[model samples]
Target: MIFFIYQIVTKPLTSKLIRNEACPVCNTQDSLELTLYMRYIAMLIPLFGMGRRTSVICTNCGNVLKNPDSSIFAKKKYSNKVADAVKDIRQNHKRTLWQLVYPWSIWFILPFLILILLGISAINKKNTEEKAKEYAELIMHPQTGDIYKSTWFENGLSQGVLVKLMRINGDTLYVVKTKQKIQMSFSKDEWNKLSADPAAFEAKEYKIKNFSILKETNFGDLFMYNNDENGKQYPIYLGAILNSKCEMDLGFETIERKK
Candidate 1:
């Protein structure tokens, strides 16, 4: 169980030393300094800003005067110099580049991630189209060492199955099914592992009519199914073949290996 952790971080943005200003607590001259702080919320990265706070401190006594006029400076007479200093601090207040950017980080971060996702989706779609074209070309050839990858939709879950062309005898094509059904949404490493080992494939070979069993769908993709009276397609049989590359580097000697 993991959760997103957020934190509130406070950082100093601007600081100004009030010259000739005396600390009311310690009576130390030229000790008062006013600082402006920016508060921001952060996750793994700094997300956005919360608010700001002002603080006044006495350097000699190491005392923090949060409110100058309402606290110790209440009894002291408000001088022209002190009032001008406050105005100067406000006028001179400026934030650094990071301080200005981190507060409104969400404005850019969301758009940046969205652009990345759209780029990835576009690449995947292009790859799928190219693979479909290769499959259409090789599906008609029906050569040995050719592996067909299909998605089996069952119980709202899709599982992947790999069928390999063992041999072709007369009008029948001998094919071997994979022992373990690969997940439709699987990693390349998982597919490579199953295809590498000979034991991962079924020992008994199945036979299907060379051209009769092979049929093209409306989308131009080829698949193996029975063309009986009701055009029955078995769930155990292979569905729409996704990949048509003769040699997928699955430790098989095919057209790619010869090239």
Candidate 2:
């Protein structure tokens, strides 16, 4: 359950002297003091000010005239002397600096945070695109240390495995598949662990016949292969590679598992 607690609170700000002013309610001379108050609504933080009120209280007669600047002091028209006195008091009253900044935190801080998040997201996407381009180039020119991480279906369940290139003979690519089959819901740490361990891969070599980069899409090229054992054709798309680092490449796309 979610609970929202908010309150409308009134806080006293600075007080100013209303010189030569008489309390209209008590007729007390030079006893009226003007105080400024701030009323605001708060939810976790002060949201905004409802309004400001100026009150005049007489120290001599103990009479309080709330919001004396509202045209009426005691059910009578405000005289020029009282009006000028209240105006001067209001002009002098100032709230503390903290009160000014706390209430508007959302207004200034939220947009700045949003912009920072957007900039980070844009940078991450740019890096991913750049890494994809680099991985595509690596795929075009097959290397000895190149690791091709691929996913395939096995026994009606999705499985993930890594294939490390041992060497590439003229038209054939020799590679070793990982012995441990990971679930499709794979983690980066799991991939890295398998890539770093030499014992995690198979002992024998698997040949991918007629292995060449088929320049098809702008994102990345495809590797067309003809498995010699089963005489089956399959594609290994370079775009499927999801590695941020070119050294330990991984894939999210599917490649048929060679038996």
Per-residue lDDT for 122-237 in model 2, tens only? 87778667766655556666677666666544466656677677787886767777888676544666655555367878887766542343443422222435556677676543
Where is the poorest 10-residue window by lDDT in model 2?
250-259
Clashing pairs in 2: none
- Cα lDDT tens digits, model 1, 1-259, are 9998998887777777788878777888888787777778889777776655556778789876555324433653435666576667756777566666654677778999999999998877776676555555566567887666655454777677666778888766777767777776436565555563567678877666563344452231233335567886542343445434422323322112112
Local distance difference test scores for all models = 0.61, 0.61
Instruction: Give me candidate 2's TM-score against the actual structure.
Output: 0.64
Instruction: Supply the global lDDT for candidate 2.
Output: 0.61
Off by over 4 Å in 1: 1-16, 21-29, 41-48, 57-103, 149-162, 167-172, 178-205, 209-215, 218-259
| Residues forming the 10-long window of minimal summed lDDT in candidate 1 | 250-259
How large an RMSD does model 2 have?
6.7
Clashes of each: 0, 0
- Where does model 2 exceed 4 Å of error? 1-5, 48-51, 60-64, 68-98, 101-122, 148-152, 184-187, 208-212, 216-240, 243-259
